[model samples]
Target: MKRLLIACETIRNEVELALKNRAVEIETIWMANTLHDSPDRLRDALQAEINKSEAAYDEILFAYGNCGNGLLGLKSEKAILVIPKYGDCIEILLSETDNLERIRTTTYFLTQGWLNGEKTLDIEYEYNLKKYGERRAKMIMNIMFKHYKNLMLIDTGAFNVEAALPRVKDIGELIGLDVVISQGSISPLEKLVSGQWDEKFCVIPPGHPTDYDDFLGISLSKP
Candidate 1:
């Protein structure tokens, strides 16, 4: 079946890795990672893409989680919509890990794809430092990261985790959080691409808009 995969660029590396060697006839559209900052905008952007491409594909896959309800109203008039059953990309990547609930509550996760995004933590820090001055920037950062005790750098095997550590460590120091490394899986993405839409995914039929109820009962915790 012809498929269109619309995904956040924040997980571009993982998505690409998941599609490698796959026999499926799929096309991909990568949306800006920064769009995640505004759920409303993300919703609008995704809807626009779906409207434009729905008629041409047998199925449309979203490499995203609920994303603060960004996917709430998205629907395809002519194609099935498949999405991960998680709160966000972080949850999707760490889906196979044990203690996921505890890890999400106390840790802020990062990946190379995330670090390379336009609105990465370091970029935000620099912007704040420039606009609000160093003192205020530090204060703002501290407040923003107060809930996180550790900055987890997840190695999804799509990029060099070793090379990213220095930058991750610097960001952790800037936010007064400890830096830790963990392995992340792209199995969820792989499953999506390979049509393994099991319990970990939400499969919506044509003309059926995704609802908040679709995500209910999924164990998700936002960091």
Candidate 2:
């Protein structure tokens, strides 16, 4: 089957492993540059690649669970596949077992702490990010990992990296269900501007969890 691998962060290793295991033929590799707003541009570029591919693949899959990057605009005549983001997949895997309430509680607590501004690494210039700043970012990640570890226990009955990789590995497995894949990529700012990806792809980046995003203070206006 004809395949496309859209490279994105977090899932690079997983994608390679899946391709190796499934023996899927990768017809083209589209790498989007997400340096600045490049993630947004990358989504557009991927869409353009899809149109240009001339329907060569019977199906397409988004390799990363983080397909929220501006992809809602893409409507394919062929089968389109998506792997839910890490958070969603974790929620799903947790659902398969018991303790849904506990998991929700843990996620809630961690997310809440993040919104309140917890910091692990005391980096300077953290306030420049326009979001919760670096302090809050690390806090959110730590909280996520804490809850993520607990969630993994539902699968492995313990908390460890072994549990975590499997969670990511499962995402790759989901992508394998389809023939074509859409994923995210990293790029230098220069490559992003020259590539013109936004003409086609759309980036649908998810917001910080409702309770965790301090940046919710930013004013949003409908154009």
Candidate 3:
């Protein structure tokens, strides 16, 4: 079946890595990372892409998670919509692990894709520093990241983790948080692109809007 993968640019490296050696040939469309800042806008952008591409492909795969309910209302009029059953890319990267909930509460996840994004934590820090100077910038950053105790970098094996360490360290220090490195697996994305849509995926038939219950299997209030 012809398939098109629409994904967040923040996870481009992982998605590309997953595509390697796959038997399936799925076309890709990378969405802007900045849209992640607003779920409503993200939803609109993804729906627009789906509307434009649904007729050309038999299946449309979303390499994204619920992402603050960004995928809540997405639907395809022609192609089936497939999405990973995840809350965010961080969960997808660490899908093999058991302590995801604990990690989510105290850790700020990082990856090469996130670091390379247009509006990364470091980029935000620099912008603040330029506008408010060092002292105030540090204060602002501290307040923003007060809930996070560690900056956990996922080594997805798709990029050179060692090459990203210095920047991760700098960001950790800037935020007064410890730096941590964790192994990550691309198997979930691999399964996604290879059409292994098992229990780990939310497969929405054509004409069905993606529901919040599809991801969690529990009815939660829509955002």
Candidate 4:
């Protein structure tokens, strides 16, 4: 059966890596990660894409999380829709159940995709700098990042480390946060792409409309 993987460009590396490793014969549609800036717009865009595939695919998988609740109400009529049942990609990166909460608390996670995605804090920093001047921009940035104590880079082994490491480190420096590099596993993405929809995923069968409640539950996979 033909499948379509719809996802933000942010996880392109990890998703592609998983697909390549699994050798899944699914076609991918890359969407701009900037859509998150406006949740309603993102929902509309994703729904439009999903509607387009109602006749083309037997199964359609979303390579995304709840995001800022942007993907709250998406549904499909002809194909089963599947997605990770988590708040954001941070959970997908740190897909381990045992240490999930331990590692994610007060942490602002980073990935190669996040670094390149639009409408991010870093992007806003530059915008604030130009629009509000150094003083006001610094205050705004501080307000934005005050809750985050660590800037973690999820080393998913999906891309070249030599290049990505420095970028995360530099971002940490610019943001004045402690930089941490952790070994992340693509096992989650690998499992998702290969149809191992365990407790960690939300499986919305065909003909069912998705709801916000679909994002709730114990979705951590067992070790």
List the lowest-lDDT window of 10 residues for candidate 1. Answer: 214-223
CA lDDT of each prediction against the hidden true structure: 0.89, 0.35, 0.89, 0.80
Per-residue CA lDDT of candidate 1, range 3-24, in tens? 9999899998888889894555
lDDT of 1 at 39: 87
Consecutive 10-residue window with the lowest summed lDDT within model 2:
177-186
Residue 88, model 3, lDDT: 82
Which regions in candidate 3 have their CA more than 4 angstroms from the true location?
217-223
Provide the global lDDT of candidate 4 against the true structure.
Answer: 0.80
The segments of candidate 4 whose C-alpha lies over 4 angstroms from its true place after superposition are 97-99, 218-223
Output the better candidate (1/2) by TM-score: 1
TM-score of 3: 0.95
Per-residue error for 134 in candidate 1, Å, reads: 2.3
Give per-residue CA lDDT, model 4, range 1-223, as digits (tens).
6788897798889999999999886788988987877878988999999999878988888888777777777888888888888777777777764576765666778788887776665777789899999899889877877877888878888877668777677777767789887788778788788999998788888888777567767343222
lDDT of 2 by residue, 1-223 (tens): 3444454432333344445444545543535324113445755676676666536764444443223334334445553433233332233223244555564543322111111223311221243334676566555545534533222222212223343444334432322211111121222111222222332222223221112121122222212
For candidate 4, the TM-score is: 0.88
What are the root-mean-square deviations of the candidates from the true structure over C-alphas?
Answer: 2.3, 15.1, 1.6, 3.9
**For model 3, where is the 10-residue window of minimal lDDT?**
214-223
Give the per-residue lDDT digits (tens) of candidate 3, residues 1-223. Answer: 8889998999988888889847656778999999999999999999999999999999999999788888898999899999988888888899888878877789998999999988888899999999999999999998999999999999999899999999999999989999999999988899999988899899999999987678875224564
How far off is residue 1 in model 1, in Å?
1.9
